[model samples]
Target chain A: MKMVLAILISAILVDNFVLSKFLGICPFLGVSKKLDSAVGMSVAVTFVMLMASAATWPIYYYILVPDYTYLNTIVFILVIAALVQLVETVLKRFIPSLHKSLGVYLPLITTNCAVLGLAILNIDETYTFFQSVVNALGAGVGFLLAMVLFSGVRMRMESATETPKAYQGIPITLVAASIVAMGFMGFAGVADGIFG
Target chain B: MEKKGRLSLLFNGVIKENPVLVLLLGTCPTLAVSTMAVNGLGMGAAATFVLICSNVVIAMLKNVIPDKVRIPCYIVIIAGFVTMVQLIVKAYAPEVDQALGLFLPLIVVNCIILGRAEMFASKNSVLNSALDGLGMGLGFTLALLIMGSVREILGSGTWFGIPITAGRIDPMSIFLLAPGGFFVYGTIIAALNKLTKGRAIKRKSMGCDGCPSAAACGGAGTGQCPPDKEGQS
Candidate 1:
């Protein structure tokens, strides 16, 4: 239980996916233009991360690492693709509303580096099954947190009247991210406590 | 089918339509791993090799892949190439592989690869697709190198591994970090946007009417296209 909490907190705060580790910056920037899409993208990342961990953890331990380790990349990717498909079906069947909300994003999650990164990271870090799941959940939540925060900030940046001639649009967004990243720097202590 | 005109395809990835600056795909790598010029060049070369190879293979097998599973098929092909590169780099340039880290395998998910596959390779002939991949790969490398140079100098006081900042400057480490990546990419993109505008002005002076995709624009849904984009280059 303590380890579970450690992984969760470590992923969410200490080594935050977006702000600190820089896993999923594409969606954090692109889908974050709108608040709704930002939230939607977060949910999608969460789903993919959770399912990817659940699936890839076993594949790593039983199949890939022990037997065909050379095929880690290929196998992990194939597993992630299958898991995305499974999640799509489950969402479409169980949560139609969620399916609608995360329509295209459901599949797009397959391409989200965060998902594949987490899947491979599971093996790299060699987390226990439960730990990997908790870590994935926390990482997903962290990604959502960072994306929403960025979107909210960008919403403000867009509405502002003007700025320096140079620091407009993307330049400014990046500056804002720099500040956000600095803020996340404070959470580095979280990892110290967890790994300690 | 025959590939589009060679010059058009080649030039497209460089200026008129750079995958990173213009199309805005692969934002993760553009902003994450471009901290050092060497890392950027290594990653770019690796990505370029994979991009060209994957484009050719995918384009040739375009007809074989069913439309429904096209995304999966393209991903598998891409993942295969990425794995091959990963192994090679791991064996030889382990340092570069470490610098890239997860971003290497993350190539499977790099939108630039699949985006090009779905948009250009899936439709065009093998020759054009290979050329497109080569051009896009070079443009991507150029963007990375530019960003890498900016970050390395400002953030670390070094240029391409030669320590030029010995007691000469105090680097802003933030610019070398991930956030720094975004700021650099944004500024470079804004600059590129301005250059595109300059070209547009020249074309308008020459009386070419306007761009082909002017009606389409960048933010098609939001109706806020980036100032001027005459993809006529």
Candidate 2:
């Protein structure tokens, strides 16, 4: 139990997928302009991260580990692509409301590096099944936290009139992201302090 | 086809339509591995290898792949090449393999590779696609190298791990961290914007249009994404 809590807290606050590690930046910059879209994208990404980890962990250990570890990249990507398509169809048919909120971002999530990064990181860290899931959950929640925080920063930038023309659009947004990331850096040792 | 000449296609990627700066594709790796100049160069070379191979292969098999399933086909082909490169790097250059870590495999999802395949390779001749890939790969490499050089110098006070500051000035280690990566990338884009005087395409122009999945997505033909939420912002 303590180990799970340590992994979860460390993943979220310490090695945040977005602010600290720099994964899923495409969605981070693209879908984070509005608060609603940010929430939608984050939820979709978090769901995909968990699902992909759940699916890939078993395959890596049971099937790919002993004989074919080199096939990890090819196999994992195909699985993720197929999984996203499957999830999208099922969501649309059975739970249209959930699909409506999350559907647009679902297809895009297939190409999201964060999903693949997390899957591979699990193997690299040699984490057990439960710990991997906990880490994924932490990563997902961390991503959501970063998206929500950055979206607020972007909202302020949208209304500000004093911004120079050269710093408009993506540049200013990135600069604001830098500050948010700096704030996250403040939590660097907090995880260990509390959990250790 | 627009009848673009070979040299023009090559030049198009190098300057006019740089994948990183102009197109805004593959921002993840652009920020991740760019902390050190040598690491950035290694990553650029690896991605270039995968990009060129996948582009040529896709261009060759463009007709064989069914139109509806082309995106999946492109991904599989790209993944195969990424795995090959991953193996080769691990064998030949263990240091780069270590430096890149998970990002080497995550290149399978890089928007630049898929974006090029769907936008250029699938429609053009094999030779043209290869050239396009080479050009785009170089452009990506160039951008990464520039960012790597700037960040390493400012953040770590080193160039390619060589001590340039001579220990006279204290290095700002923050430049080697996550925030430094964002700051340098933002400043570079801002500088590019000023230099181009808005001639280059900016993020505002890069919604679903340049996105490779835009074709099969529900947001197809819509310039905006999160289709219904455009007005809420």
Candidate 3:
């Protein structure tokens, strides 16, 4: 239990997938303009990350660990692509309301490096099945935290009229992201301090 | 599509439509592996190889693939090449493979490969697609190299692992961190915006014009996410 908590806290705070690890940055910058969309996208990503880990962990250990590790990348991506499609279809059919909120983001998740990166990281770290799932949950939550926080920063940036022209559009958002990421860097030792 | 000469198509991605600096595709690896100059170059080469090979194969099969499922087809093709590259890197340059870590395999999802497959390879000749891939691959490499060099120099006081600033100035380790990645990338884009006088197609936060998957995702009825939403570069 303590080990799980350590992994969860470290993943969420110290090694945040977006803020620290630089994964899934596209959506981090794009969908984070609106708080509502940020929340929705994060929920969708968190769910997908969990499902992808659940599916890939077993496939990798049970089927590919001995001889086919090389195939993991291709297999994982194809599985994730198919999984996203299936999730979208099932959601739209049975849970229309949920689908309406997450449907747009589902297709986008297919190419999200965060999902694939997390899958690969889980394998690289050699975590147990439950640990992998916990790590995924932590990563998803961390991403959510980053998005929600950055959206607030972006919302504030929207009203600031003094921004220079060269720093407009994506450039300024990146700078804001830089500051937000700096804040995350301070959490680096806190995880170890608490759990070590 | 304008009937342009082959050389121009090859050179297009080098500067004008530079995938990273301009189109903003594949930003993930651009920032991740670019912590060091050598890693950036290695990553660039690997991605270039995959890009060229995938482009050639996809262009060859463009006609046979149904429009409805071409996106999946492109992904599968890209993923195959990424695995091949992953294995090769692990075998020959285990160090880079180590440095890149998960990013090496994560290359399968790099938007540059898939975007080119959908936007250029699907419509052009095999030769043109290959050239575009080479050009774009080079462009992506060049961008990564620049960022990596900048970060390495400022962050670690070295370039390609060789000592460049041993004593004159202290290296600010922050440049190698996540914040530094964003700051450097932003500054470069700002510099380019200044140089181009804002002519670059800077995709507004809400617009989907430059996104590679816009057609596949948005056109397929899940379009509510705004094409720009997937800009996960």
Candidate closest to the true structure, highest TM-score = 3
2 or 3: which has the higher DockQ? Answer: 3
Best by DockQ, which number? 3
The candidate with the higher DockQ, 1 or 2, is 2
In model 1, what lDDT does residue B26 have? Answer: 69
The candidate maximizing lDDT is 3
Pick the winner on TM-score between candidates 2 and 3.
Answer: 3
Q: Where is the poorest 10-residue window by lDDT in model 3 chain B?
A: B224-233
| CA shift of A3, model 2, Å | 1.3
lDDT at residue A128 of model 1 (Cα atoms) = 88
Candidate 2 structure quality by residue, lDDT tens digits, A70-158: 99988888888888888988898999999888887887777888998999999999999999999999999999999899888888778
C-alpha RMSD of candidate 1? 6.2
Query: Cα RMSD for candidate 2?
Result: 2.7
Local distance difference test scores for all models: 0.74, 0.85, 0.88
Which stretches of model 1 miss by more than 4 angstroms?
Answer: A164-167, A193-195, B1-4, B195-233
